[model samples]
Target: MSWPEGYGRLVLAQVDSTNAEAARRAPGLAGPEWILARAQSAARGRRGRAWAMPEGNFAATLVMRLDEPPEHRALRSFVAALALFDAVGALVGDDAGLALKWPNDVLLNGGKLAGILLESLGPHLAIGVGVNLIAAPGAGQVEPGALRPVSLLGETGVRVGPEAMLEALAGAYAAREAAFVTYGFGAIRTAWLARAMGIGAVATARTARDETTGTFETVDEAGHLVLKTAKGRVAIAAADVFF
Candidate 1:
């Protein structure tokens, strides 16, 4: 019916985008609500890429208000990414191959397993998370070194559902949210880098403006993607990362 604590719950059969629903209903919401759906006809990933999510997979958005200003609240993406890591780890057992990508992507066995998208709503925020649980889309023609889409069922032969993921996600997020509030992003950054993929490795980042080739450096305290390019260490606040 509802989450144990922190977030309220609204499960839908289908919607355009959970984030869109969150934005529409965020004003009337009391505190926080996990807006989940079985299928999304218009799921959008980073860079507005069309996310092909079938009925078996999970697509949800968590709507909430952050008193902290937008700049600071943006750091919550790291927190949510880490929380989902913990949740997936709990389901499949933590493995060395599983890692977090820069910004907000979760990788499994070197493939893309999950992604988190944060959309700001003035003082509020919409944290959209998508997980490949039962079914995964084909790699379809991706660039070299690009991550292929993977699903838990394909990787572990285990079938997890949105209901189970929401429970574990809420619990995992509570702890990480507390750590973020108490200690700050510095603490979270350390843990994130520990499980980060492609750090210290040569990679390329494509932003809206330009693309830069460099070594994937560390993320800053403010959660910017740090890169070691010919121009020296550059902090990218927003970009699509690739290796």
Candidate 2:
């Protein structure tokens, strides 16, 4: 597969973490870059939770410098989610059971298939992605009440190696990124909600201090989770959503 143009690419046999590597290389990057690792010894997910990297899974980070506001930059999580959804669907040649969860997760057959994490590195942003292509942690490995993890191979019986997955993902991301930069988040948000799971359903958003239980309304233009509760409409800036 052809790599995306105007983007730097690197593949490592081993690394402490792709995101960490991105940070180390961000200062020297001339443009957006993708860092892929065969193995990561110190990987992490959102909220600094440990992220498991089984052999043959997909672990990569896209480091790019954007001159947008932090809020706009943060919306790239949705962009990444859409890219992952497209890439994986293309690989399996089907998207029947694929869906995107709020915040930063990609779901397959109602299970967590992949996750996206965004971190700031001075002027650059590191968008770390982890996909379960071959193996996934057991349900017990995740926090209680979290969605059970699933893998592409396990769910679809289609095996994809890290490099091949990166090619698809990078291209997909580049397309989505271009659209986002040109048309803004309006189109991206609309597209995301079309594939989003749990819209108009009752769900709960658990923040650090409180848990808000309400019907999943819609994701606002600012990328906040809008929920319709008995009290009124609430827009959650950040939270762990549960259905």
Q: For model 2, what is the C-alpha lDDT against the true structure?
A: 0.95
- Where in model 1 is the C-alpha error above 4 Å? 1-3, 141-145
lDDT of each: 0.86, 0.95
What TM-score does model 1 achieve against the real structure? 0.94
TM-score of 2: 0.99
lDDT tens digits by residue: candidate 2, 1-243: 477899999999999999999999999999999999999999999899999999999999999998878998999999999999999998899999999999999999999999999999989999999999999998878988899999999999999999999999999999999999899999999999999999999999997799999999999999999999999999999999999
- Residue 62 error, candidate 2, Å: 0.1
lDDT of 1 at 189: 92
Q: Candidate 2: worst 10 consecutive residues by lDDT?
A: 1-10
Q: Model 1: which ten-residue window has the lowest total lDDT? A: 137-146
Residue 151, candidate 1: C-alpha displacement in angstroms:
0.4
Deviating ranges (above 4 Å) for candidate 2: none
Per TM-score, the best of the predicted structures is 2
Candidate 1: lDDT over CA atoms?
0.86
